[model samples]
Target chain A: MKARVTITLKPGVLDPQGKAIEHALDNLGFSGVEAARAGKVIELDLADGTSDADIDAMCRKLLANTVIENYRIERL
Target chain B: MKARVTITLKPGVLDPQGKAIEHALDNLGFSGVEAARAGKVIELDLADGTSDADIDAMCRKLLANTVIENYRIERL
Candidate 1:
């Protein structure tokens, strides 16, 4: 089985990396780009019969930093 | 309007970062984790009425490294 976990900063958290990328984009002539927030995508190949609850626990415990980020899970 | 762009490496591409992360996870006692792939998520706050086609073009032209990555866009 395969799953995708997307980790993104929570709203109101300062994202210096995203700001840097936005600045670079502006310098590269991509106008009208008001803001950019950067995040992480983690693809996992799991054993058969792995429960969604287990995956969610994994995200909460290790995959995402809940202090500043939220995670979404997609199973494929 | 806001759009989310997810950039992921094409299948079969080598992902050193993902591998490193996986190794770290294993060291931290995350068992049953078969493989890991790392990617980028970029959120964009665009002006109203930005066409999907234009956003796709932006992704292809700048947001993703098409030589090894693929991108998907979502509007919110």
Candidate 2:
């Protein structure tokens, strides 16, 4: 099975990395970019028949800091 | 308008961060993970009518390193 985990900061969380990118883009003369939020995407190759619950558990246990980030799982 | 840029290492490139994650997952007892690839996702809040060419330019010039990375842009 193949799964993709997208981890993003929760709303209202400060993202210094994202802010840095935004500023860099502006300095590069690509104007009109209101904001940018940086996040992580992890693609996993798993054994066939890996259950959704197991995937969720992986996200909660290690893939994400639940207090400040959110994760979405997609099985492919 | 909103846009997303997904930046991933080109196949065959070494990814130490991903390997570290794979090892950590194994140590944490989540088996069946054959491999893992780490990537970045940047969400952009842009002015309405931002052109696709402009977005592509952003990816090529700063958002991704074309020599060892691949980037996909999606408009939302």
Candidate 3:
């Protein structure tokens, strides 16, 4: 089985990288980009039948900070 | 309107970050993690009714390197 984790910064957190992208876009003549948030995606190839609980644990332990970030897991 | 761009390395591209994560998972006792690939997700808050073509152009010009990565766009 395959699993995907989408990790994003929580609301109210400052994202300098995202801000840079937004500014760059504006400079490149792409107008009307109100904001941008940069995040990460990790795709895992796992053994079949790996439980969702185990995946959730991985996220909590190592994949995300959990304090300033939020993560969502999808099984594929 | 909102849009998401998921950028992933092409299959043949080398991903040292992904490899490091895979090894770290193994060291942390996460078995069954056969492989891992790291990617990026950028969420954009754009003006309403921003044309898909404009989004695609932004991706091509700034968000993704088409020679080495593939990107998927989702409008929300």
Best TM-score among the predictions, by candidate number: 3
Where's the lowest-lDDT run of ten residues in candidate 1 chain B? B24-33
User: What is the CA-based DockQ of model 1?
Assistant: 0.68
For residues A1-76, could you state the per-residue lDDT of candidate 2 as single tens digits? Answer: 8999999999999999999999999999999899999999999999998889988988998899999999999998
Cα error, candidate 3, residue B43 (Å):
0.4
Question: For each candidate, what TM-score against the reference?
Answer: 0.86, 0.97, 0.98
What's the lDDT for all of these models?
0.88, 0.94, 0.95
- Model 3 chain A worst lDDT run, 10 consecutive residues: A49-58
DockQ, all models: 0.68, 0.89, 0.91
Clash pairs detected, candidate 2: none
Q: Is model 3 an incorrect, acceptable, medium or high docking prediction?
A: high
Candidate 1 residue A2 C-alpha distance from true site, Å: 1.4
Best by lDDT: 3
**Candidate 2 residue-wise lDDT, B1-76, digit = tens:** 9999999999999999899889988998888899999999999999998899999999999999999999999997
Which has the higher lDDT value, candidate number 2 or candidate number 3? Answer: 3
Report the backbone clash tally of model 3: 0
lDDT of 3 by residue, B8-69 (tens): 99999999999998998888888989999999999999999889999999999999999999
Worst 10 residues of 2 chain B by lDDT: B24-33
What's the best-to-worst order under TM-score? 3, 2, 1
> What digit string (tens of lDDT, one per residue) describes model 3 on residues A1-76?
9999999999999999999999999999999899999999999999988899989988998999999999999988
After superposition, the stretches of candidate 3 with alpha carbons farther than 4 Å from their true spots are none
Tens digits of per-residue lDDT for model 1 on A1-76?
A: 9999999999999999889877877787677788999999999998788789878977887789999999999998
